[model samples]
Target: MALNLFSRKQAEAPPAIEAATLRSDRFRLERQSDWQRLESIVTALEKNRPGRIADDDLLELPVLYRKAASSLAVARETSLDAATLAYLESLVRRAWFQVYGPRTGFLRWLRSFFGGGWSAAVRDLWLDICIALAVMVAGTLVGWLLVAGDNEWYYRLVPDSMAGGRHPGASPEMLAQSLEGTEGAEGLTVFAASLFSNNSGVCILAFALGFAFGIPTLLLLVHNMAMLGAMLWLFHQGGLGFDFAAWLSVHGTTELFAILLAGAAGLHIGRSMAFPGELSIMDAAAASGRRAAVVMVGCVLMLVIAGLLEGYARQLVQTSEARLTIGLVMLAFWLAYFLLMPRRAMGAKVDPA
Candidate 1:
């Protein structure tokens, strides 16, 4: 009797296992169509390309996503096969990202960046800016003293290509004529193009070389300031210092500020890398890069304005008083925009990376 009972129980075990397998198979077959539909919708949304989905699919996406989430919950409770549970969980997670992830249009991003992002970034890098300015000022003082001691030092500091016929030996009359645009239309065009190109290169280099501990950026700033000082000294010897000052001021205000900002951006990155504090070096660097990039974009825009002023206003606006007025007005406008503009609270949400 015991042996017969054992045989019967063993025979019943196979049918019970078969029944459980059939039930799971039925469950999967019943839900497979919905799962596939949900997956297709999610894939389309994830890719973010236009025209891959139909209008009805768009409407059905949220509905199907919810259904998938429900199915996942039911699967977990009922102890469905691991493979089916995993697919549902992954599909739901992906759909969740599409539904709730950061969403900013390009125009909105531009508005936010120009409206407040750039100024905020500049404000945050105040220490770096002051350091950069100090370096430039120190360079200027050195160049001026060097040139005063020896006229030949001007040649060493100021390249001939950059000097553009204005040097220590240039007569006052020649300096005045040069300022009056006696160089003709073609010459003015060429001069403006050359100036913009040269300055742009310097600005780019200052920002690009910050990764090397900011040493190169400092040197570039000093070199730029030295050239300015040498040029100023040259004009002073020719008794045209005031005139040259006014001429340069028209665009130099904007141009110099842009270059300084670029240097500050580079210095920010270098500082973050060197002194990462509690954060990992990579994390700190990434945060600093984002902030610096905002400032650099504004720097480029400033350079464009400077180029326009130099190319057009400096050439045509002959009177020193008019040029000074334009320069001062522009300086004031930029100062107000950057320093006085209303800002959001520090805790307010900012744009996502």
Candidate 2:
């Protein structure tokens, strides 16, 4: 009777062993539902459709992401089934990005940057801007006076290629023709690209050289303004001062403004680094760099716009009055955009509601 009872018990033990579950299987099954829910929400969010995700899911994103991350760690440690491990790894990665990775699209970022970020940065450098502007004005006057006191100074101040025969000795017809824009010039696309590249290079250099205590930046501003003044004096001598002014105004306003911004940005960084005050030099430079970067970006944009005007509008718009009007209008638009546009942090989004 005892041997028969023992045989029956042994037979029941085999059946119980056959019904047992593996550790990996049990682990996966217990959390599969949560993983599925997390994946669905992640997929919905990935589409970037504004209203597709429910409010509850949005609120739950961090929690879901954390749970999946924890699950992945456990799976790696326990050597779970290959399929389960792979699935969790992928799910965790995608969920992590959705939770913490960059969310702003290019267009949205651009709108925020141009809308207020650039202007606010510029405004913060107002003192630097004033100093730069004063230096430029002084440089211009110095060039003009130097040339006026001695015509020989004109040759030294202005490059021959840039002068394009518009020296003091040139007749009014020759000087006026130079201001006639590229009306007769060929390959305007090439001309515009070249002009843009040259201007951007100067602006970029001015910005980069600010680390040298801004002395290079100041010198660059002086050099640029001196050329302008020399040319202005030359045109004035030719009796076409208004025509020359109009031609320059069309593109010069934008171009010069861009230069001013670039110079100020350089000065801002240099000043901050020099007089860190309470902050360390590195911290001051980093803070100033952020602001200067915004100004430099806008400076490049302004250069592009100036290039377009120099290439097309300056040539197409014939009348002096028209040129003046357009230049002044663009100046006004830039001023209003910088001073009056809606203000916000650099990359902050508007409330969708």
Candidate 3:
């Protein structure tokens, strides 16, 4: 009885091993042609040596990848031999990249962004921009009126550190000197860094606080511009309003514009969530977030430009005319670029740009 049991066990093991070997061989033979073709195409693509792959092979890449992926799944379920499973996996990975991976390099993506992608995105948010602009204007007026109604309001609106010696009822001489870029080279460098940090913080915060229907973003914008209004009223009272305006404009043109875009971007996300329309809230938010993110990237670049203008150019050029010229030129350039660049790239008329 023991001898019979041993013979039966040995016989069963041989049959099982033969079945597995046969399955692996059959699987390979059935898909071997596709696997080879996919491997060739993937190799050519990886080399980035264009014109090496035939047009037909390029078109068939996706199909071949899907087939290989399917085979991998089957091989695992059937417990195919290790070598065959490994080959399928390797082939599938290489083929998958050629079929679906990103083909655009960094340069290509950068060109696309600055060329028209950014401006087009901005155009889409024009409505939000208008709304944000209106709210900012209103906030500025509120600050000005508050301070005008009571001088004490200026202190409340403007921090002592920022106000320095320039405050309500400050003599015109001191206020004028303040605008003359009296800060030395080292001081200007430090001031520029500080301005960039502060401005960037406000812009990012405005953009990041869009989830609660954008109320916080709106409030933040109002509060931020209120400080500007207070300072403006103070300068005007000392009869240095025009000088202060020119000073602020030099960098404020770019800095304020960046803040405007940030507020708009935040509003867009909140608006999408508030009114998802045909899509679910999550879907609407996801789509709007993508669009808003593009706008925010451009805003960051604008803020950096603003920082350089404020920190260096504004401090170096003491003349009001020169400051105004620089500010207006920057403003005009931004308006034209955002309004015209995309149309020009698309071969459209440049009217109103």
Judge candidate 1 against the unseen true structure and give its global Cα lDDT, from 0 to 1.
0.80
For candidate 1, list the clashing residue pairs, or say none.
Answer: none
Window of ten residues with lowest summed lDDT in model 3:
344-353
lDDT of 1 by residue, 101-174 (tens): 54567787777776777788888899999999999899888888899999899989988877778777778888
A best-first ranking of the candidates according to their lDDT comes to 3, 2, 1
Q: How would you order the candidates by TM-score, starting with the best?
A: 3, 1, 2
Error of 2 at 253 (Å): 1.0
Off by over 4 Å in 2: 1-101, 182-186, 348-353
Tell me the whole-model lDDT of each prediction, alpha carbons only.
0.80, 0.82, 0.84
- Winner on lDDT (1 vs 3): 3
For model 2, state the Cα shift of residue 249 in Å: 0.7
lDDT of 1 at 306: 91
Give per-residue CA lDDT, model 2, range 125-188, as digits (tens): 9999999999999989988888888989889988887788878888888878777755554677
Query: What lDDT score goes with residue 55 in model 2?
Result: 90
Report how far off residue 161 is in candidate 3 (Å): 2.1
For lDDT, the strongest prediction is: 3
Per-candidate TM-scores read 0.72, 0.72, 0.81
All candidates: CA RMSD (Å):
10.4, 9.0, 8.3
